[model samples]
Target: MPVLDLTDLPAACPPGTAWLGLDLGEKTIGVAASDTSRMIASPLTLIRKTKFTDDAQALFRLMDERKVSALIVGLPLNMDGSEGPRAQSCRAFARNLDRIRPVNVAFQDERLSTSAVERFLIEDLDLNRKRRAGVIDRTAAAWILQGALDRLRP
Candidate 1:
């Protein structure tokens, strides 16, 4: 399967199918999932980085358990909106994942996603640095997924 645009995602999957959101960092992969109705996105879990096979297996396991029908991955675009190494890595990861599972994949613009999540955790939630670090990845994944879900709203 190819990486799809947000507008195309609903067409790719059946209604009431769950969607998995991923924020792939160097050391961890943050996971989030939407309700079967595609209305709410919530932080799920974090996968500590390991070998590619292990990471993929872990992601696949989550998808299977969650009954995920599509994947929405955060793409870390440069400030100028140019594709940088991180963005390329995200695209590569999506392509590789597709090769393994052949599921619908989509990318959401993730500029400042992490920073926004950290700020929210600190200011609104009043979380300390250590606590923030532990949850920031999955929170950012939810933020990213929420953005895409909002776009899908009728």
Candidate 2:
């Protein structure tokens, strides 16, 4: 459907409907899902990038399986809050996906999200680089979605 702002998420995805969080990277797309009550977010899967069409299909399949109706994509904004090429690519990805799918989409500023996840994986969890790489993206996706869901709470 339409791309929404963070503030527009609750209204678009009412209660009892799940939403998917997407951390879109150049080579991989990390995915997470919220509980039906919209309270908890959990890392789901990582989709290795192939072609745009294939990527979109994979995303849709996930949404279909989970009955998710909304998407919260992490936008890689520069530290200065400027939209760089990465952010622009995210926007384009959202728009292009919206054109073909019927899910509501929104972006959450993802500054340092991956870094934060990486730090947690290392310091707190004691995971090495290889192990961190395995879960970093999906964990970052959860981080992004949790931030948005926190704002949605009263």
RMSD of each: 0.7, 0.8
Pick the TM-score winner. Answer: 1
Question: In candidate 2, what are the lDDT values of residues 66-121, reduced to their tens digit?
Answer: 88979999999999999999999999999999888777998999999999999999
Would you estimate the TM-scores of all the predictions? 0.98, 0.97
Worst 10 residues of 1 by lDDT: 94-103
Q: State, as a TM-score between 0 and 1, how close model 1 is to the true structure.
A: 0.98
Model 2, position 26: C-alpha lDDT score:
88
What TM-score would candidate 2 get against the native?
Answer: 0.97
lDDT tens per residue, model 1, 1-154: 8888899999999888999999999999999999999999999999999998789999999988988899999999999999999999999998888787798999999999999999899899999999999999999999999999999899
Over 4 Å off, model 1: none
